[model samples]
Target chain A: AQSVSQHNHHVILSEAASLELGCNYSYGGTVNLFWYVQYPGQHLQLLLKYFSGDPLVKGIKGFEAEFIKSKFSFNLRKPSVQWSDTAEYFCAVNARAGNMLTFGGGTRLMVKP
Target chain B: DVKVTQSSRYLVKRTGEKVFLECVQDMDHENMFWYRQDPGLGLRLIYFSYDVKMKEKGDIPEGYSVSREKKERFSLILESASTNQTSMYLCASRIRDRSYGYTFGSGTRLTVV
Candidate 1:
C-alpha cells in the first residue's frame, strides 16, 4: 500500500516570508503526485500535480514543487507568502496502476500580516 | 469547470442514527470518492466508486457504506453514527485517467452527538 507523510504539522510565517512544506511518499513503482489546498471556510482545490516531465512544476499563486524521484519527495515551496495563504495543505499520491489516492497528514499554515 | 457538490455543509445527528450524505458531480467522471477530514489527519478515504452500482472499500470503511446507482451521484451512509464519526466529509471526482487530479466538493461537516 502507498502512504504519504508530511513531517510538518503546523507552520507559522509572516508576510513576505519564504515557505516550504515537506511531503514524502512511500511507493516503489511509478506514481502521480498532487498538492491540494483548503482555505478557511472554503473547498479544497488543486494546487498542482506532477504526472511526468520536468522535475519542477509551477502552480497557481506562484507556488511550485519539485519532484525528486531519488528521495521520493515532492516538496511544496514558495519564495514569498501572503497573509491569504493561511490554510491547510495536503499532499497526495496515486500509484500508477491505481485509481485511488493516499493523502498525507496535512500541514496547517498560518500566515500573519 | 468541473464541480463536485456535497449535499450539506453542516449536519447534526444523534448516535446510532442512520445518516446519509449525498454527493453529485457536474462532470461525467468515471470515478468518485468519499473521504473524511479531521484535524491533523488530513483526509482519509472511506469509499470509492468506479462506475454505477460498483463500489470499493477505501482505507477506512468499517462504519460506512456507499451506494452508487447513478454515475454522477454517490452516497455515503453511516449504518450507526458514532461520536468518533464526527468530522468533515468530502467528495471528489476524477476521470479514469490517472494523470488528472481530483475535483473536490465543498464538504459536509457532520457532528454525531
Candidate 2:
C-alpha cells in the first residue's frame, strides 16, 4: 500500500521566516504529488502539484515543491512566510492505476507576527 | 473556478440516527471523493465515485454509505451515527485526467452525540 509521511507535526515560525515541510511517499510506481493547505474555517486548497515535467514545481502564494524520485520526497518550501500563511499542510500521493489518494498526517504551521 | 459545495457547514446528530451529507460540484467532474478530517489523522477517504451509481470503498468505509445517482451530486450517508464519527467531512471533485488537481468543498463538520 502507498503511504505518505509528513515529518513535522507542528511548526512555529515568525513572520518572514523561511519554511520547509518535509513529505515522503512510499510508492514505487509513477505517482502524483500534491501539497494542500487548510486555513482556519476554510476548505483544503491545492498549494502545489507535481505530475510529470520538471521536478521543481511552483505553486500559488510563492510556494514551491521539488519531486525527488530517488528519495520519494516532495517537500514544500517557501522563502518567506506571512502570518496569513499559518495553516495546516497536508501532503498527498496518488500512484498510477490507483483510484484514490493517500494523505499524510498533516503539519500545523503557526506564524507569529 | 471549479466549485465543490457541501450542503451543511455544521451538523449535530444523535447516536444511532441516520445522517446524510450532501455534496455537489459544478465542474462536471468525473470523480468525486468523500473524506473525513480528524485532528491527528489528516484526511481519510471514506468513499469515492467514478461515475453515476459507481461507488468504491476507500481506506475507511465501515459505517458509511454513498450515493451517486447524479453526475454532479455525491452523497455520504452514515448508517448509524456514532461519537467516533464526529469529524469534519470534506468533498472533492476532479476530472478523469491526472493533470487537473482536485477542487474541494467547504466541508461539513458533523458532531455525533
**Top DockQ model:** 1
TM-score of chain A of each: 0.99, 0.99
The local lDDT score (0 to 100) that residue A113 gets in candidate 2 is 100
What is the lDDT of every predicted structure here? 0.96, 0.95
Q: What ranges in model 2 sit over 4 Å off?
A: none
iRMS of candidate 1, Å? 0.6
Please, what are the lDDT tens digits per residue for candidate 2 over residues B1-113? 99999999999999999999999999899999999999888999999999999999999999999999999999999999999999999999999986567899999999999
Cα error, residue B77 of model 1, in Å, equals: 0.5
> What's the TM-score of every candidate structure?
0.99, 0.98
| lDDT tens readout by residue for model 2, A58-107 | 99999999999999999999999999999999999988778787899999
